[model samples]
Structure formats: structure tokens, C-alpha cells
Target: MAEEQMNFQAEVSRLLDIVAHSLYSEKEIFLRELISNAADACDRLRHAALTQGGLLGDDSSFRIRLKADPSARTLTIADNGIGMNREELIDNLGTIARSGTAAFVQQLENKAEGANLIGQFGVGFYSAFMVAEKVEVATRRAGEDRGWLWSSDGRGAFTVAEDADAPARGTRIVLHLRQGEEEYLDAQRIRQIVHTYSDHIAVPVVLESKKEDEPDETLNAASALWTRPKSEITDEQYKEFYHHVGHAFDDPWLRLHFKAEGVMEYTGLLFVPSQKPFDLFHPDRKPGVRLYVKRVFITDDCAELLPPYLRFLRGIVDTEDLPLNVSRELLQNNPRLAKIRQALVKKVLGELKQKAEAAPEEYANFWETFGPVLKEGLYEDGQQRDTLLALARFRSTTREGWVSLADYVKDMKPGQEAIYTITGDDPKALAKSPQLEGFAAKGIEVLLLSDPVDDFWLSMVPAYDGKPFKSVTRGGADLDSIGGGDKKDTAEAEQQDEAAPGIDALIAFVKLTLKDQVKDVRVSKRLTSSPVCLVADEGDLDMHLERMLKAQHQLDRSSQRILEVNPGHAMVKALAAQVGKDGAGGVVEDAAWLLLDQARIIEGEPLPDAVAFSQRLSKLVEKGLLAG
Candidate 1:
């Protein structure tokens, strides 16, 4: 009977400070936020029938309407779906954050995973405060007939009044655009925003556009894409939807058209883009999948709709069942939502495995652009690691190209029990490593890894299929023991270290002198001709990655790496003999420094002591001339 005025919750004021100033990067996000909320209500109505039909109020068709008042400079978003009551209006708007919203957002920021927070909120409704000087939320619950209007200036408090004639079952939000924001009242502006961000929505999103005969005509597909059969939607239409919904120009590399019918009725049309979206790194990039309840547009707020790793994917996910709110808090906990997201992930990955097997080249390009992100799965999601792994591709030791674990498994030696790999900063460099010389001689292939994310992925994807992944640099290289045969050069190195005048004792002497920097100085077990090599201590961080992190974070100091030496090479042999002659001979010390420096150079590393290295180089050249 009477309008009631309410005070803003203590947190509401604090939240207003953040929503207006901090929450979003652009003021336009308010439209996205509000529009998303309206869509969620429609989606919830579409699905509520299966669980408890009373919540939807017999409305089968749900749509969103956009209206503008040129003279008043006002825009309104109205939906014919489930609406909220007085308490809901206050909880949604009067509080800075409901419990779940605050907790999830805080955890993300704490974990420094806020880079993908866009659309992961219920607070998105508050974004309207960013552009509207005056805002009104008029809603009536779907099953109930009475309506209430809550209006706010977004300063602190709000006013709620009874609405005698609130249209049908949904909520209508009106925004009095700020002076400079009056442009949003333009028909063109409205169409642009809806088509750019809401085209693939499962519900109709109508914008007022000028027509020849009528003053205004509804413009936009405003239709659910996934609800339609695959026969009706063309590939070009699908691409357009991807570009519009994802703000991505790259055409999708793969499209997964699926309908999960038996247990849960849902239709999903998802696309794997050929490239990462421009804002893939932005913390506020909106989720590309639109959520629908029984084909009615709901919310696109849950990045959880698709796993965070698949945040780059774009498409529509229309389900007959899911909660109707745009709040990430509810979506995260909702059993139906969690199930759909999990199923979607498996389906996408399974489709990927199919692509990797059926059309290897296409999936290869997809992997190249998205591999590091997918590798992240190996560490974070062990349950799906093997499945995601079946789609992985890598460079082979014997080939100039990439190979899948499946292919490698097929190529393995009869007795080989593990999938062997070697990681370094440079793939080409690892390929040339003396450690691989013995494997090559024995016809064993090692996967070449150059990505910084390689080790991180390897750390997570510890095993592939039934075979475990073993880093070749770690241990049990045992190349000499393998195949019961050795390369001619390996044989010579073992012989050279043994028969070449007093070499075993010399090696021990060199180890004693360089033990501080050297791990273990053994006669060449892997190196055939290379004089010296560096191997990471078994299970320690590999060389290239250590270097990468050091340079990436710009750490002031770095951990020293272990140096491995090749015993058979003449340089090593000569150094050993010289060390045997004089424990602290000036020439021998110089030779020791040279041996370490030479090993560092071959690994593409700068010398730990560069100036001293230059001096040693000069001495070594002089010594050669003096000998001649």
C-alpha cells in the first residue's frame, strides 16, 4: 500500500565503492552484467519445470526486451522469466556481496587466479551503478502475482514500492543513463552491444531498431542456437555466433554439437577457436558460453560452465535444468551445474582425442596455440590427465617433427616400459645433447621439449597411458646396458679413459678439484664425441626451465646448476692428465676453468665468471701456438 525506504547494508556502501570504481574495467560492463542477470532468470524458468514446475508459472516462452526513451535518455532490460521479491532485491542490490560471491572472488584473488573472474559473479547486477544515475528493479516472483519496484541512486539506500501492473512473470530493470552515457539510448548502440556480446544467447534478446513502416522493430536473432537441430544452423552461422559471443575474430577449429538426453536434457554447441581470444589474459574477460534453462536465455556468468582451462572456448550451453540465477555463488554449488560442466569438459576432451586421431594436422595447430594451457591440466586434473594426454603431441628424437604418446607407445622397443623424454630451454639444443647420442645409436627416440610450461606439464602428467614418463636427464640412462651393445664411439671413450695413460686416476683427481661445481665425473656413458656435458641432478629442476624462471621473474640471485663431464673426449682427458700432474698447477687450474666454461657454452648458458673465461680463452689459444 505504501512505498517503503530501506537503508543500505553497511557492506553495501563499501561494495558500491568497489562496483562503481573497482569491479569492472569498463562502464559498459554494466549492460553485460544486467543483461546476463535477466538471461539467468529466463534460463531458470525454463528448467524449473523438471524439478518443481510450480516455480515457472506455466510460461513456456521467455524473452528479453530492450526499450529506450529518447527524451528521457533511459534504457530498460525486461525479461519474461522468474523474478525476485523484496528480500531478494535487497540481497541482490543492498549488499556489497552475498556470502558465496565474496568468498569465491576473494579466493580467486588470493590464488592470483583472478585473471578469469569475468562473469563469475552475482555482483554483476551492481554494475548498473557504474552508468546509471538512477536505477529501478521492478520484479514479481514467477509463481506469485504481486510485484514490487526497488529504486536506487546507488549512493547508499533504496526505495521499494508496490507495482499493481508488473508485466507477467519477469523482472524489468530501468536505467537513467548519465549525461555522457546518453549515447546508449541510441538504437545503433543497443544493437551493437547485444549483437557483439549476446548473440548466441539461448533466449531471444530484442533491441528496438527503426523500420520503414514501424517506428521501431525488434532487431537481433535473440534465439537459442543449441535448441535448433544441427541441420538448420550453417557453418557460417556458427562462426558468426562464435565471433559475436566470444568477441573473437578467429574461426573455430572444431565444433562439438551434442545433446545429452537421457538423464539430463541438454544441447551444447561449442567451438574450439583457432587462436586465443585477445582478452584471454584479461582478468575480466566474459565467459563465452551462455547458460539456458529449457532453451530460455539465463546467465553467462559461470566460467565454471566450462573448466577454467577451457575458458577460451566459445558457444552456447542450453539445458532443460539448472539454477536460474546469474550469481556464481549459486552456480558453483548447484549440483546440476557442476554435473553439466564436468560432462562438457569430458566431451570436449573426448572430441579432441578424436580430432587428434582423425585429423592430426588440424589438432596439431590447435595444440600448438593451446598446448601450454592444456598441459596445465596434467598437473591440476589428474583424473582427466590420461584422456587429455591422449591428445598431446611432442617432437621425437629421430624425427624433425611432433609425435603423440599413442604413436610413441606404438614405436617403443619390446622391453621399454616407460615413455622417455628430455626437457631443455631449447628443443634443438636437447636434440644435440650428448646424453641423447647413445639413445640415437640404439634407435631410441626422445621427445624434444622447449616450452617453459613443458616441465610444469611433465610434473603433472607424470605418466602416459600405462607407461610412466621418465626425464632422460634424471637417472638410469643405462644406455650402455640397454640392447647389450654400445656405439663404436662409446666403446672408444670407455677404452680411451681406461687405456689412455693413467686416466681413471686422473678423472678421480679432477672430480676432487671440481667437486664443488661438478655432480659426478664419470667416463663417458652417453657422450660419444662431445668433450663434456651438463646434466641436471636426477629429479632436480632441468637447466632450461631454471634459466627461464630466473630471467622471467628477474630474481636477483639464482641456484647454481650441476655440471656433468664427458670422460673420453680429448679435452677432458687432457684436463684429467694435467690435474694428475699438478693438483694446483696454474695451467691445470686454467684447464679446469676451461672445461667448465666449455660445458656451459655448449648448453647455451653464459659463463658464471665471464671475464675469467675470456682470460682463459686467451691462455688456451696461446698454449696451442706455443705447442706448435
Candidate 2:
């Protein structure tokens, strides 16, 4: 057969134009794409050798080689894998040009987020145009004797010709770096990109030997980091892989790298980033935890590798036992892989618990970054829930920053049957909660859980130990009135409130007046100075959380509140005196609404009806002056 030369299809021309011009903002990413393609080729050959009887035959220092010539302004990336013949090249490249263009266009329209589109779609080969004026791929299939050359200027046309001197079983792509992009022709630049994006690539990546007296200094570790024994690798090496795989440099505050060889055979090198990345919340952030089959790169998008809640983790997992073509969907059930996944979950959580136990301060930092993430597992992961609960940390009524369940338990007051908590959006407000009421008098510490996800995690875990978590604002927490416990001071306060003129009658009046807005109004068993505090009906959502959910558009409206009043307070007495006065409707209603307004404000909630709250407060002051 003879060689063939033709122009690119018109749409291919348009796609090439986009790839070269508007597709990628950082042309350097083209190098990453090319190196990734080379790594993928090597991974295929490695997998085939193991499963498909060595299509590559012998000669197994499997690697990708790079060559650059500054004078010629050319950068070449070569891979010794299952190379393509002319037909394969045309199907892979030309197929995209003619039919794949629309798919890529649709993708561009749907996700116009950032310019990291090479890995997002399967057209990474065309990304060469971002920096190259022309690209040439000379290749030979591993089992074939014939060779081929595929060349294109990326203008919708390409030429396929016979090659007498191509590698016997490899593909070499030479990129003629354009104008300002010619710097890529520097061997040093190529080496940097390979180390960053393709370093952990199961096989070695070799760069051309530039020094006359020495061989090529391999730019990457070239060895799989996961397969190595845990003791032999330093923490620095662990952190480096974390950065490479995660596109981050922050040290990993915690790491779990090991191989499970019993029921399943897989090596995992995972890291917990010391600080959360900016894209931690991005819905499209690529999962960089690569999957490998016997050191052959499979896919980084394998959600089965780790649950979505643990997406913040980064690393590699190389498995020697799985089939190369394992459909990602099948990861859920492959018993061996599932076993491996289970081990990984245990290993990560165990490491976190060990860290928190070993160093409280370091664990505090980890909590600040990932505690909420860990808490998420409490609700979603049932089998792992117990471990995550033990690993949980919190801020309490007593601690400065974070307190573990163990620490809170150590400080539990004698005879305290329930661990108490008060949930409000603001810490300071909750700290002063009149609802925290008698709990403070008993000298019992309460956990101050305030994150938006607090309610969700708390729902999963009802009790830490034998003590059930009791929300202070619940309507009927009968905190056995200071009894013989701390009655000295409470008794004195009770006497003072009782002696205050008209106090008992006023408590009755405030309750009757605010009946419509309150669930059930009663004299406070926990009142100190404040006249009234609102509690939610027994077992209702925290007042602050209900409002927060509504603020985030998660809830429609707030639940009603339980209003508790101080019996011995003078204001309750004064308001009580005028309860039955002739034409006291406007004056008494104004005073009741004003008390409700002030109570909600102190509890860190907004008046639901600000206009009415204002009008009522104005009238209260006017009526007081007329009485004077």
C-alpha cells in the first residue's frame, strides 16, 4: 500500500483553531496532556503484558522518553507502548475531527468553567496545537513490522505516510513549539511538566541525556510510590506525591499509605491535605486519586476508590489483581476491590484517630480543616460510623477550641444523666442563653456544636456515651430545681424575685398576653436576670438552626417558641398591675410584643415582624411617660 496525504475536514479545522487559540488559557497544560497521553500508552502496554500475553513481547524497561532541541525549536514526547498504525491513528484523530467536534462543542457550552479541558474530554492529543505550529507522530504497533507517520498542522487536514525508521514498538510525537512558546523546546521545561503531572505514572519517564559524559538523569522517581514498603518511604516523599496528585504544596497533616495483600491486593498512598484547597467545593474538581492495574494507570475519576465525602483526600491506588477493563461502575461489587476499599476507609480513619490521640494541637488543626468532613461520614457511612464518632471533635461550653468526645466525657459532672447543648447561630448568644438556664447552675458542661452541618451529624449520633444529648432549649427539660444541689444562691435569687412588687401576678400577665406567639408560656425555673427566654417545643429543631436553614433557602419558616418568664422579676409585677385596667388593650399588647422582640434579639434571632415590633415598642415608651 502507498502513503496518503489530504487536508483536514472543515470541522476538524475549526476544532484545531479552537484548541490552538481559545481552548486553553495556559499553554503549559499541553505538555501535561502530552505526558499524560504517553503515560496512558505505557500503562496500556503494562496491562496487556500482564493480562493479554505481552503484546509488546520482551524488552520491558517500559517508559516514555522526551527529546528537545532548542535550536530547531522542537519538543518530542515518545512512548514505548501499544503504538498505533495509520488506521488506528486516523480513527483516533480523524474521528474526533469529523464527529467528535459537536460533542466537544456541547461540552464547552455546558461547562464553561475553567480551561482544564484536556482531561475533561478525550481530545487531549489536539491540545498540542495550543503551543505547537505543527505536530508529527511517528509510530509502529507492538506486534507489527510496518511503521507509519501521522503529521498535521492542525488546520483540519493531516497526512499519513509510510515510515521506514520509526521505533519498532512505540510512538514519538514531535511538537514544533510556536513563536513565544518555543521555550517548551527546552529539556528542563519538559522535565518539570512530567514530574508534576506524570511522575506517579506506573512506569518510568525518561528524558534525553544532555550531558556528554553521563546518561539521561531520570527526571521522576520513575517507581510507583504506593508499592514501596511504608517504613522505607519518608514523610517528605509522601507529602510530595500528595502535592503532585492534588496540585497542592501544603504538607499533608495526616497520611495513610499501605498495601493490603490478604483478601485483596491493592496499594494505596493517600494523604489528608493540611489545608483545604480553593476548589474543595467545586462540583467539577477532578478526583486525582489515580487507579492502576498492576502499576498501569487506569483512571483518576474512579469514585469507587473513595466515597464522595472523602473527596478531599488525594493519592494513588495500584492494584495487580483486577482486570484492565474493569468498568468503573463495577467497583461497587467486585468483592476483592470492595474489601480493599473497606480496608482503606479503616486505615484513613484509624490514622486520624491516632493523630488526634498523639498530638492534640495538630489534631485541632486537622479538625479545623476536615472535622466537618469527618462528621459527614457519621451520617452517610454506617459501617464506618462508630470509628468516625470516636474521631469526632467539638467546641464545648468549657473548652477554648475543639474537644473530643473522650475529653467531654472525662469532664462529665457526677449524676448528670444527659450531656446538654444549646444550638444557636452565634456562639456568644448561645453562651448567654437563658435556656442554658439551670444547666450552668449544675456546673455541667454542654457541647457547643454550631456548624451548619451540626444538626445533620447530631441526628446520626443521639448519644456519645450513656448520656443522651439534651438540647437546652427543649420545652420540658425539668432540671430538678436547684434542689439540695445549688439552692443557696438560687434560693436567694428566688426570694429576691418573689419579694419584687407584683412579680407573681406579672408572670401570669406576660404568659397570657404572649400566648398566640408562644407555644406554652411558664415561669422560668432557670431565670437569673432576664425576664423571659423562648424555648422550642420538646425535641424541635434548634431555634437558631431553623432560622439558618430558612436563611439558606433550605427551610420555609421557623417553628414556634416556648416562652418562659421569671416569676420574681419587678417588670413582670409592674406589667401584672395594669393587666385588668380599663382600655389597657393597646398598652399591654405593646409591652408583651416588646418583651418577645427583646427576647428573640438576645437569643440572636431577628424579629419576624420588624415593623410591628417597632410600632409596639414606641407605644410602650409613650404609655410609660403618660403614666408618669
lDDT tens digits, residues 1-628, model 1? 6999988876556556555554554566566656766766776666554455576555676778888887887899999877887777777777644344454444434323332243333355666877788898889977776898999888888998889777667899999877788878887877777766566565677775545566554555666666677898777667766654554435678889899988887888888888665445445645668776665456666666876667777878887776444454767677887788889989989888888889888888888788867776776777787787777788878775578888898888656777888877667777887777657766777898876668777776657778888777765466644453346754564564454555576566656767677766655566667766677767667666677777878545544445555665666656555654543366666766677778788777787789988897788678772253
The C-alpha lDDT values of all candidates are 0.70, 0.72
CA RMSD of all predictions? 9.6, 8.5
lDDT of 2 by residue, 1-628 (tens): 4668776655456667667675665667676666667766776666556546657666787887888888788888889988888889888777553334564454444334325333444566777888888899999988788899998888777889889888888799998878998678767777777766666555677788767887976777777778777777666566556655665535676777777776577888787887665445555544557788876767778767777667788888888888876665666567776767777777887888788889979888888887766677887898887788788887777668887777777777665677677765657756877766566665667777766677776667778777677777776766554233466656645564454555555556666777777777677766766777888887688776787778889998678888777665556656766667788756766777787887888777777899998877778777772244
What local lDDT score does residue 487 receive in model 1, on the 0 to 100 scale? 63
Provide the lDDT at 599 for model 1.
78
**Going through the candidates in order, what is the number of backbone clashes in each?**
4, 6
> Model 1: what TM-score?
0.65
